[model samples]
Target chain A: MAETKTYREALREAMVQEMERDENVILMGEDIGVYGGTHLITDGLIDDWGPKRVMDTPISENGFTGAAVGMAMMGMRPIVEMMTWNFSFLAADQIIQHAAKLRYFSGGQVQIPLVIRGPNGGGVQLSAQHTHSLENFYGHFPGLKVVAPVTPNDVKGMMITAVRDPNPVIFLEAGALYGTKGEVEDGDNAVPFGKARIACEGDDVTLIAYGRQVNLCLRVADTLEEEDGVSAEVIDLRSIRPFDEDAIVASVEKTHRAVAVQEQWRWFGVASEVAAIIQDRAFDYLDAPVERVSGAEVPAPYARNLELAAFPSDKQVANAARRVLYMEEK
Target chain B: MPAENGNGENGGAEARGEGSVATSADRLVDLYREMVTIRRFEEACQRGFRQGKIGGYLHVYTGQEAVAVGFLDSFKEGDRVITAYRDHPHALLLGSDPKNVMAELYGRGSGIVKGKGGSMHLFDVERGMMGGYGIVGGHIPIGVGIAYALKYHETENICQLFLGDGAMSQGAFHEAANLAGLWGKDGQCPCLFIVENNQYGMGTSVERTTAMTDLAAKFDAYGIEHEKVDGMDIEAVLEAAERLTEQVRETGKPYAVEALTYRTAPHGAADFFEKYRSKEEIEEWRQRDPIGILENKLLDSDAADEEKLEEIKGEAKELIDEAVKFADESEQPPIEELYTDVYSGEDEYTGEA
Candidate 1:
């Protein structure tokens, strides 16, 4: 059974459910308790769980994030809010040095069941320092599990899976889509990591993305269908590190044409990985080279027009899909 | 001996006020033995590093033996202990098998943490030795978090966080200390910050590193009560450890103790230049060596004679020799182990299948 819920509500419900089920599960972040989360993803949680469980930390990202790593080692499932993914750079040492490598360095003696979640990517013109898409940055580490779920259902379900996983999970939420509503399953509907969800199936060409870019791909799929009479399959790569290579290969094997999309800069982005994987695995299929639709290589500007120009748009994705489909770009 | 002539006038036992727990002669002897064992073990490590038997950066807790030995004496079951890269002494004091510790330095399969951590990251969780972190000030927050969890779980256990004098400059230390103090107010953080002010950080002395040389007083910024102790004196450290550990356990509040000590050996095994300070300065500190002071105290108190001290030294040598032999004989970790332990579940490895 399922009900329609906003991405924020679904995300909060997933954490609340897990916290209720497991006493070890707790939330910690700046302004999460008394101030209600900056994004309100954890709003009203302090009243239910109290200050101990819903901890409000100081503006020390390195300290609290490292503390969460320690708590996770001691068997507490701490979900640390990074306010935004941009601030995570301050705690990158803790996340990369300690949280990621602790289990390996400790010879499997400890497990960091830590979930560091926050809004990622720029949409509301928060400018340079405040905006970032860090999936590729974190996914490069071997010990971390990186996932960016766009849908409310996937947000709720993936969060459940992330909480239960015995490794550190980097949850990249679509900051722009917290108010976006979708069908969310009730109760423990945990979606497993390392699997791709085929958002829309088609036979001609495949459109691949994750986070908010998944919605952009769907929109591009509609435009492609109406304008070029081309069928575009949309694949949401929900997980990045434990990537669904088989799903990508299978989708490419069927459609024979693909366009990898991301809101990150072109250099060393997730799209680059996707393109490399496609060429390595599904080269036998007679299709054109995979096209990568990525953001312009520049820091996000404060102006709305400049910001919109910086990110991947429907037109850019559609043209990329059209180019792969061997059709004229509109 | 130069040590006998220098620092010999410093009074022992009667110097500090008597606490409820009177340290017995037997306990003093035991503490001396442990300190000597650590000294011998560290000396062996230096030899092993020079011979290429032990790889990576080798940081020995040579002259700073008494600090760990004294502080760890109050370690109770379930209390967690964590420290920086110079960690063999902490692990050994917490009862980690010396063979495994030596084997780890040798990069062997049967080593503690399975040869992955080397000298910098020794972890014996079963013995409450959380880990030996490599980064300066990085483990502070983790230690505070462990204390928070201890309180969260409604346990009387506390976490003993060992940091170097250099780490005080890092933002992580200040941030974690603030959190410790904040949480301690509500009886939710039972973290004991033990700053081992061992004179120098690598080659930079504490005075050169910070304008404020008093590292313990720095804790005052976080509102945590703190004190200083002669890290060279085992009795002083033991006295402070027993009383402070009890206070933290009872109140679940964070506390700080700056143990002023020195590393008589070179910063690293490869740091042979000795250019940071003069040879005369080294000689001066050597006269006040912790082991030498403890030996004088034992001799003056009639706790043991020269023969007893020699026997203890001989025993420590034999034990360390055995550990070295075991480490040399141990096997390297299997190739498959490279892919293991990256992640914990069914899909344990993310690399090539």
Candidate 2:
């Protein structure tokens, strides 16, 4: 019973407590039942789940996300949304060939447990066709899980493990942190998926990030320990396709330097798979080559200082955490 | 809001001259032995893709076996079926197991997707046959989201889906026919779609793709309810799949039929030299051969002869030669099943950290 809530009211109280403890969940998209979700986070949820479990579809994002992957291949736990992950590139072939390869081409006999969700990167301007970070385009698919939570208690505990994970998740969220806020934790809080939290800890340099670039890497790890005494740390990832990567190689083996950050755009981003998983398993505990930052390969600009120079900033993640801590250079 | 269709012109030659005038004689000899076991399991998947034992691309549903045996013999038992990628006669007419659809076209490990969806994906989904889709109007919004999950599980079950005719100029089939015409305006879309119109998409036809080639009047611009049968007539596609699956299970809505039909091979099996189309328009649709018009309607009603359709084509070539010796003694999956079902719960959700 801790309250606070606002990442769009904890993503609408995690779809109103999983649509009141599942009657096989539901909630389709496109003006999410009576104009409540163009980011109103499913507003008054079709007046408490009516229109047949709050459906309201028709802008046909690949026909209601391929009819929420045919109502999640018959067992129904739907929850589609996609009002923007830049219009989910019009249902990217029913989310990469039928909600991520229909249970390995149906040998596992189907279980899409679909989630989808919406709002992805590029702050406000909404220029390049309603911006999009797409966590490395849905964690470069392979059945898909891809979380990206960022707070308000990890989007209501990872929207209850992407509505009880059977498969297809993607989630993302963060249209400029829907009125930010934080605290959350109420009931049946569910978060598990590939873990990664350590949002503030510190060492000489860790950083990393996730949706809303983990509050700009916790405000650039609090201005690099209050203006350059330098502690850093941060982390936040919160699932990018089952990516805890042992909490990012144990935070670059306890901050022997790393940076990452995102918003999306530095060539194949999610900060280039967190700087190649911190140089593939804390390469001799990194100390240097792991920098990243991202988001300005163009296309998200409609002015306002060219969409604040296309994004990524707290002075470019404090200059990539002062060039991975060696105090600036490479 | 378009619904009221009717202009399906000659509605598939008036449902192939009045739907086989009350057919019987043992369900037209079990629909001419399941359309000669899908033309002998797609001519043994074109000799197992010319003996390399089939791997990847092999579309062939050859002249679309009476639109997958007249709408999977009018579905019903927990109705469901989906298609695209000329799926080996919609998984040998929706019951799969022809040695697991020839060991999922010889990829093996008792195939039927255990061979992880080979020839343009193939699934069984416990006999509801919910897959085949190798993109092309990608499973038409997954058959309007499996008829919106069989009307969200209250089930009077329904979902036909199949695609082709270049997936009716895909925008994922006009956004799954406008959300099965807006969730069938509250009957919660039961879905049917079908289309098939085999006119050619790979070698581009349907009058070079669409100036409104009336693919059942494009589901009357998405208000759904459409028609147009005669897919080389298997009793006018089982009397329009028993009157559109009993009017989509009594009004759960979402229909559309189309059929028309023509692909007598060459959209795969490495599309032979047959440039676009010709050879007398593929010998005039091989004289409307839906198994030679049901063996000339079972010898004009003697109810089958020519040595009983040559002993039902010698028991469909000895059940496709024991499904090609049970897919040449099955088993190939190994390599630790290349990391099982992608991700459904631990195997460390794959991408091995």
Candidate 3:
């Protein structure tokens, strides 16, 4: 039977199950073991897996992450948790240079099959430097795949898939969704890359989102039905590299309207790209110009009120949907 | 960990990094041939690029053939070899078909990396050529990770990593080196870092780029056993590779070799010769060219005559010409192919929706 679990718990379970199944499936990151992960994502893993499998490394992202890349090249399935997206910048050279391009440059002889994952997105006063979007930063690379899982089911499934993937994968977990719970497959569940999931079905307008923004978009969809009678279909984009443009286009073709909701800044955000793709491939079906509900273009603030203002919420998504539904320009 | 390698599955011995014994002149000559092939291949690439027969960032390893050939001499059948973008010579020496390498340069499907990799990146995993990386210091960590797998799979294989002087300054090199040293001490590492200190990292001298010009000395900070070798001398390099690889297998320790060599050509065909270095310095390095030294030695030893050398040159030219023709006739990768291989060929995972 499928059991309900939190995002963090589901992630931990995925790692544990994979480690149990394969001996070479090891994890290395900052405080991932006995420290139980800063987000408690790896709680109780050290005792079960021991020091070799669950490594709590030094603060050197470039060091440990590069080492993990090395290990991955040699056929070990290494999962490197960056602790947070903010810290990955320090190891950007290794991630972009070595991990991502190894396969293509090596003439396809080697497989990085390395996953660098951690909490992403800004919320609850995690100010400035700690709060930035990486969709654009890492998405710029060619060989690497960028994934952001929102639901617990997605968390478990995608993590398993990331472990098995031969290329280097950057798995971004929405920090806000760690406590959110959901039901997952009973055993050995794995979700593929480059696929989008439709969270809710609607007809009037489509709300495309990913990561934590799915929850926010779902809330907006509910509000649109109650107040405006606008049926907003929600599309949860799972993979960014092999982006599901076909899904988004198909959704827009049916709805004739599109509103992309993102927790990241609007400028060059994933939402902006989604809107562009919709307009590019499915522009003829559009009832109105696509609108984007994105986080404010500024450093995330430490203050609770300012932090709330920095990111998109249900009100923003609903308003964006309304704008797309109507002839109004935004 | 309770016997973590539960699958009991492993790749070929080449991936495992195993070594084999050799005390014969035939093998030595074969190693020399490998070096000769690399040297000839590099000169051809330089000529091809100058004539607009190639494209992209082409980093040549003309003067450092001995370093690659020597290491491969000691590299057991199961060992792994990874290096930086300056990788044409490495591929040739590691049993990669010179014609295929040239085909790759011409963008042919028959190339070593199926024409996907040009001069900078070439791969042959079955032959244990891990990769030819584009980024300067990027592949060092990858080499270390391969070593980790050798140990993980309970194999006595070693990883031989090649990088240029510029890569040594990259933080990835330092961090990976330190960790390889630490983990290796406890038996989870089997890597050797070979810094091809060709004096310049794209025009800028090592003395100008790094404070510690002694590249081998930098490994001392990471606690890896390191030594300096005359990269031009094939015998010196072979002896060092044998001793260093043995040390790695026995102690599970990491070592670094600073092959003091020089690049005879510009950083790439795109680069103009006058921007960074002086003509005099370039001329001086040319006087001690690895190929010239070998040619002189062969002439003195009577192991062969000038006619044999000419015949070797003729064969090399014909092979390069054939490679170019094959690559020219080969098809470019299809548009659909762009999405494939971004992940492993895992049967359990479906990447395309």
Candidates, ranked, TM-score: 1, 3, 2
Off-target runs (Cα >4 Å) in candidate 1 are B1-21
Predicted chain A of model 1: TM-score relative to the true chain A? 0.99
Question: Which pairs, if any, clash in model 2?
Answer: A70-B145, B305-B308
Whose lDDT is higher: candidate 1's or candidate 3's? 1
What is the C-alpha lDDT profile of model 3 across B94-147, one tens digit per residue? Answer: 778777888788666666776666777888889888878777777777788788
Q: Give me the candidate number with maximum DockQ.
A: 1
How much is the lDDT of residue B137 in candidate 3?
A: 77
Clashes of 3: 14
Candidate 1 vs candidate 2: the lDDT winner is: 1
Give per-residue CA lDDT, model 2, range B237-308, as digits (tens): 888888888898889998888888888878887876378787898889888878887776566555655666
Please give the lDDT score at residue B264 for candidate 3.
75
TM-score of each: 0.97, 0.42, 0.88
- Best model number under lDDT: 1
- The parts of candidate 3 lying over 4 Å away from their true place are A226-231, A246-255, A280-285, A325-330, B1-32, B270-287, B292-353
Candidate 2 structure quality by residue, lDDT tens digits, A1-330: 888978898888887888898888888887887878777888888887788888777776877788788788888888888888788887888888778988887777887889988888776887887887888877888998888887888888898878988888888887788888979889878889888898888888888887777787888788777778888878887888778878878877887888887877888777777777777777997768888878888789777888988887688789878876767622
Error of 1 at B202 (Å): 0.9
